[model samples]
Target: MKTYFALIFSLFIAATAFAQNDTTQKIVEGRKNSPDQEKKPYVILISADGFRYDYAEKYKATHLLALSSSGVSASSMIPSYPSVTFPNHYTLVTGLYPSHTGLVNNSFFDRNLKESYSMGNKTKVADPKWYGGTPLWVLAEQQHLLAASFYWVASEAPIKDTRPTYYYIYNDKISIHNRIEAVVAWLKLPAESRPHFITFYLPQVDHAGHLYGPDAPETEKQVHFVDSAVYELTKAVTTTGLNVNYVFVSDHGMTKIDREHTISKPAAIDTSKFIVSGDDILVQLYAKDRKDIQETYQQLKKEAVDYKVYLKENMPTNLHYGTSDDWHNRIGDILLIPNWPKVFNMYGRKQLNPGTHGFDPYAVMDMHATFYAWGPAFKSHLKIPEFQNVNIYPLITAILGLNYTEKIDGTKQLAQEVLK
Candidate 1:
């Protein structure tokens, strides 16, 4: 009985240790970089979620400023409309607009599947059928190039029936030192087995922004943390004696919201008639019956005071959203977009976060994200004008010499401008 109790205690301790620092690497075996792929240069595609275009300047992120100044920097990279996390992160990898990729918002309902997807729902996030477009990792793996992801939006899913050759399920359990060490280890592998394309993500800045407003010193501290972390990762990579390119981007920017006077559900729309999805910045109404869309839209428009209401059909074409652009039909029928700074609190049941995103990136400049690239694959001391985020797909593919035939929205113009 004492031995059995000891075994139980040991199991509990083992589980606790695993929970603290989950360094489990998921690998797809029986994959190798071809001779041609092995010759290709390396790319460490990094996304700093919610790192705005100006944060490095505003916060004096020394490492990032110096690193990007040496290579290529964008004035601002325009996130696709409803500039939010899940959608834009997925957009960065797939090079498709949220409408085209079917990840319309961080949380949205799919009328056809009679299901919904949310960033918090691990099951929905991991299911491959919900994703659309050929992600860059998939594009690389399909062409016999090995790829890896430290953490990415859909990297956990078997999208296109192919996961990255090496990846980690999204988690914050690992320390920055461990993450940097992992990247260095991946690079140090034999040429044929090493990943030519790697992805890394940092959520520190975004988390700080959301918790403490963008202008807070607390947020600035996180900015510096990311700055130091990236510098460390790159510094570690230098030890491997391999040329590893890096493109640092963000899913979207952050903005302080008016949390005091949050918008409430309009009395004009009956909850029984429509299913609600979305949050403070964007509110989407999915009609229970097809007949409810028009009436609900008209009523919401009449009642909307601080927000704009539009039928999915009438949404601005520039957003690349609406009836015509709804490739997967995941977009809401009646959409409500709160004007800048105003956010919905639904029934006023809960207080709101001081900072938020998911606004129109063009209309609200605060929603624009960052883009910085460096290493042997890119031009030096070059700064480009603001470009749409979709163009990033072609840029990385161009760097890694990965050919993609899919007619994605991103063009090769940025690649031609930035690469050697």
Candidate 2:
């Protein structure tokens, strides 16, 4: 009898020790989610670049559509002015307008650095140092949470002491499969170190759309490619038995433009009079000689019959551009916006080939973007009436429980709409 009793007590003690250790591990790893975490809340922000909302429905992305049918969905998302990828992505992460985030264009003169910064140059890319605002990933790290990014806006750039725990260098050529692989690798890490926040970017949809129109069959197929990748990623994450959340978003919608639709300065103006900055819909004209401002302005105005020409002081206030000192100097003295299909690039002898963005965001062809949410954290079967790309930042920060108090131009939060 005594021996049997001893064995039973020993087993009980061992089981208690194991349970205690498990609880301690959960706390140490920061995975001890609250009672409210039953939804298996985790976030995966996926960027499909120039995907349009209607295509998402028309093509019947069963997986993505299920997310909308089960969780919150939006008919369309509005993009900020000069809606290029860099600016729009920055806005998504920082909750700031292009002017506030200092990414007004993909390629712009950084007066402070006395050098031009562009999306192509990794060295000159925007970072926490140059950005006046904080990205959600930085905030996540500050809160002792592990954040990983496969490929996201400015993820490669070193931010003030806060870098994603894991990140891949931004590559325009990286296939959808590789991006999914990288994300799965990070999630499969030791449970204690698994990322609490993850961001994945698929550039093919946007890349192909820029070369073709967003509605082109090629672009639609590209969207399907990304959709397939997302479906696979979701399955992988769920199989790991970790609670996760997913967000599908695009930087901006796309528009079709060709050479026949292009406009430029009349042949009479001296070609060498100004430095030409290439923005498809918006033209930035820098005077080669400051003394010619008045004459150049008059000449540009005379030829600007097809587009809207605005002096720096008289620029549209609603566009949320041109008011800041940094923006004023970086932008040309005169800004020109073209009508749809009608676009403009710096008019030199060089032949311009290809479609582009950086147009007004409210045009009939430009107003709508795409957004979708899935997993347990989102509000089920809800539709958000109106939202912007900048609203994404607040949603990310809130989901990660990061402490950020900076005043971003975009303060709206989608948590209530997306979270049950």
Candidate 3:
């Protein structure tokens, strides 16, 4: 009886030690996979343009909701100032606000370059010379990790002196599902060349939101469709049993700007004198031909009350915008910010709906976007109330275990919750 009791007591002590070690081991593993934990970790960053936080709760988004429930979530992710698509999206990868990033407005003229940058075409879309600073994909390559982009601006920029290990040029014909298919295919590549970093951009939501308000049934349908695509991608990847980190985000929310209160062209200045960048809400006033800058400045200033006007030299300082040599290359000569309940539309565009973005980011309309993270590297059911989309750079850099030198505009790593 004495021997039996001694043996049982010994067994209990051994089991307790193992249990304690098990808990510690999980923590150690968690830390090992944290964003800053590894130098070459697999990661995926998805941009569902115009995705709103409320939509997540209002709609049946099993995949996205699962990601939020199992990982981290925020009520809304605010965008940088001048919350247009390209600028906000660029901010995400570069970790800099639009003002600092030089994408101040959606459509602006490059005085030095003698051209304009718009969302259309390869020349405007893929020009590396126009882009500034280092992006996430370029940084990933520096650290020896393969980075890939399905179709995001500046993705094809020749800044890095070499292309991503795997990349696809922007093609509108490629359906959202096809893009996700390509991403999954890349993930299944041979282990030696499998992409460790990936960024996916979906235009469906943004398109629908632009055509219809966020609450419109068509836009709601688009939200569901993209959510389903996300589900398919997530399901496919997890089935492979490969460890991965994922983040779903948006550059900015959509607001239905009222189409009234437009500023008419001054009769004093020839309407043909300037090449307008945007129609009504935002307009880049540029010289259509050589014109007197002083005279033009005065004409615009005299009529400023009708609009929120800013000369290149006097754009709102709060925006962190400036007309530096590089910026002047992309900054318009003058900017017109229309008042509330009013939107701008250029006279020539064939846009069916008269709605658009390219306005202040602080307004209630443009402030909210989306931010959520999931996978093996995140804390479950965590909520980060305040975070910037720009922080996404550092987060992705950490996930892929790469070194990013740029002082990130938003660099707060979701580190606390990510560790066990």
Q: After superposition, how far is residue 146 of candidate 1 from its true place, in Å?
A: 0.4
User: Candidate 3's residue-wise lDDT over 266-340, tens digit each?
Assistant: 443445677667655566677666555557778767866556767777776656564652343565666677765
- Model 2 has how many clashing residue pairs? 4
User: lDDT of candidate 2?
Assistant: 0.70
List per-prediction Cα lDDT, in the order shown. Answer: 0.91, 0.70, 0.69
Cα RMSD to the true fold for all candidates = 4.3, 14.9, 18.7
Tens digit of per-residue lDDT, candidate 1, span 1-420: 999999999997886566435669999999999998889999998999999999999999999999999999999999998799988988998899999999999999999999999988766788998899999999999999999999999998999899999999888888889988998999999998999899999999999999899999999999999999999998999999998899999989999999888888889767799899998888898899989787777777778899999988999999999999999999988888999998988867676779989999889999999999999988999999999999999999888888888879989899999999
Worst 10 residues of 3 by lDDT: 23-32
lDDT winner between 2 and 3, please give it: 2
Candidates in order, TM-scores: namely: 0.95, 0.83, 0.81
Candidate number of the best TM-score: 1
Residue pairs in candidate 1 whose N, alpha carbon or C atoms collide under 3 angstroms: none
Residue-level lDDT of model 2, residues 1-420, one tens digit each, is 999999999997886454323311111233322333322246888888777667678777777887677877888888888878888888888888877877777876654465566776555663455555677777776666677787777876667756677766554455556666667776677654667788888777777777666666777788788778888988877767776778888888776666665675554345487655546666666666778667767776777766777666677777777745344256666667887767764444255545556667676455467888877767788887767777888777777666678887666457656766
Cand. 1 Cα-lDDT: 0.91
Worst 10 residues of 1 by lDDT: 14-23
